[model samples]
Target: MEHSKLSLARRLKLQQLAIFEKVVETGSILAASRALHMTQPAVSKSVHELEAQFGESLFTRGKRGVKLTEFGVLLQRHAQSLLADLRFLADDVNAWSNGVSGQVVVGVLISASARLLPRAVVRMHETAPNVIVTVRVGSNDVLFPELARGVVDVVVGLLPDNQAEGTSGNLTHVPLYDETLCAVVARDHPLAGDPSIDPHQLENMAWIVPTQESAAWRSADAFFEAAGLVAPKRLVESVSILTNLELLLESSMVALMPHAVAEQFVRSGLLSILPLRLASSFGKVGYTLYAERTPTAATQRLLQTLHEVGESVRLELIANSPSTETR
Candidate 1:
């Protein structure tokens, strides 16, 4: 078979592929060497070897740094795609060795549905029935490290922007959807009836805010900062939207929530969205997965499931315009 011919060319192709990717990423030979922990000479030699193989220079020396030649730019793009495919292949192979038929661990945010995950698991079972699917729920702060350590295969949550700071080269993110933040209050709350409320008016109201560690809370803080007001003094901190909703239901406290989760209660007339003009820069809300490499076959399939579920729910809410629904 053609696949059986995994020769020297193939092996060198993979090596050069990695080197070229790192060089393009770091933007210079010295920087690439530091990242790859190779000497500058070795890095240069590797690049030269690759150019020799292709019978063309992949990069040109420049004053600011090394710039990719046209061929190098083209190769960089294709190499990244090829490397991703190779990583996927490797993950598939690992899945087979690690008991192709067993429980798969999934990490999720507290608000995600069991139904959402089960649909994906069911699809996997149709093809690989022996694989048991298990789930763990936590905030991204708790899950990111676990995912990095291989304790969880994939995580579904809004990854903090700062979470990327020290990840080195071990993490990748695929945004599932953007969730807009909105204020959640009881249907009869003073601000609920208004077409739109100003942020400053909330300064005196009791607030049910997530702790500083949460992405939602951070966004809420940014919102207040943008309004030139501090977060309300009498605040109740909760980690999950479910808890925040409970707090809003039993008290006059208002909470910040993603529009999708807030929609559920708002439609039931249990909660009403405040007509406040929030900062358009409240930052994006989306599902992020932390994987050491590209996701495994099962993990990739699970991610696809998550994307499908999230998109379906988002589209439903958009079409219904839950924000416009009356109690």
Candidate 2:
């Protein structure tokens, strides 16, 4: 007689699944048992039972402890995700039962917080008042690690060109808007007065650029590389949005900034935008969300709000652009 597929009830128990995951992570059953407050024999029995049910050896006992077999590795991968979801579900249900919503921690780059994040937060408050939203601002290097450790529920910024590298598990990305880089200069600067400035004219000018490690800097580097020109010698490396804007106003240096950010300064007449035509395909900026694993319902709702707010902001910017003419 052929063997039947394992039923939900017959499959590995939560304790067994947890033990397998801990063993795989810690590289030893004894360590896993210690962490879970179970005896070594019990941990060993759980692994043995799972292997018997699957009709294959799940671990290879070795001098270095126990390592997973191919089948064991596969099971561990799926089991880890399952366990995470179950934990999140439990926490969410408990919060709901207590008449308090769970919290969603979000990571955002500084540039995004100005318009994108605030609008999203407002929408979230209006829609899910009980769910608390926490926002943390930093570069991707800082935020991605936090995301991986489950410190933050999601990250919103330009999607790294290579999303798969340096990540352990799958991440979800949703494109919200595309951003373009523009030159920001003080209103009194010569370039600011020009109706349109050529890109080559910026070759010898001093530039206030972001640190080389920042996403903005990377985007700027790619743009320069595509143009067959090196970025102008940096007069200052600034990560703070306010400091960069202030530098443009206090000095003759031109700063590369997103069109939306420049627009804010332009409106106040503190800075002016130079209409320099860059390569049509230079750099496309957009927002992305990264999670160590799948996101929760509350996190999903917040993401939806972000996309909606981004669309609204993009439309408003386009409508107010000088390029647009009244009928």
Candidate 3:
């Protein structure tokens, strides 16, 4: 009798998926085997079996290691989602058995990493101590896809400018608070604490701007345009908050930052906010999640804590502002 090929639905095994995912992640079957504490041949066999079942080559072997084929990339996406679901299931079961104990990977933009995320983590710790939290920081472009793909439980930072922007439309944002932009300089910069400093004069000096593709850059560019000026001729584009902070402290460069982020540095005497305020550039700060996916219990608790922290932050910002009107 002749044999028939098994459908992928019937052929797929969790073990094979796990092995394949590890190979993709490490970029080499041998490296994945080492990481998994399995023999290299065993890993290679599993990958070969997966390729046979799928009727496609998953990786291209190279002297350096391996690279995912086009099909490999596609499979990796679904594999990651499946693995994430497995983790969520394990966490869910553990929570039911022990307590609210699980892990959540959170993606954050620079703004949220400064204050909002830390405060919320501390609050979550006081309550759900067993809920382990991991944070990955990046721009909207990097975090949004991760959120949609289930790699991240939630994302925190400035909400995207619009649904049509460079973000997944399936994700939904919850506005926590509003934040405006403020120009900042090194504490010893020539314009530091100069109440009469003009935006036009700052143009002659070097400036640090967000990366061109980020939502922050769009808002910042609009801010400069509103002031009837182009971005400074001498500009350094970056998305790294730490690098930006260091650059501001070490040079005469001026940068625009979220008001809340600037206040933290200002309080520490590391950076000084320029007297200029960008009222029209108010951006919403909040957390985002996939619209269709139901959040695990641990994620729900974290979200609740974030809301509480957000309210406190909103109140604090209102109290500090000279104008009573909310941004």
| Clashing pairs for predicted structure model 3, backbone only | none
Local accuracy of candidate 1 as per-residue lDDT tens digits, 1-327: 132245535646687788888999889999999999999998999899988766778989997779999988777766766675665566577667863554456777633533345555666676666655678777777777666655577766555663432343566665554555667798877667887567777788888766777666677777677667786888887766567767787888878766666667767778987766543233433445554455666676666667777677657655545355442
**Which ranges in model 1 have alpha carbons more than 4 Å from their true place?**
1-102, 110-131, 162-168, 279-282, 285-294, 313-327
Tens-digit per-residue lDDT, 140-182, candidate 2: 8887765665657788766565333244345665656566666
Model 2 TM-score, 2 decimals: 0.62
Q: Predict model 2's lDDT versus the native.
A: 0.71
Model 3, 85-125: lDDT tens digits are 99889878878887678988999987788889999999998
Best by TM-score: 3
Positional deviation of residue 86's Cα in model 2 after best superposition, in angstroms: 12
Predicted structure 1: clash tally: 2
Ranking according to lDDT, highest score first: 3, 2, 1
- The best candidate in terms of lDDT: 3
List the global CA lDDT of all models: 0.67, 0.71, 0.83
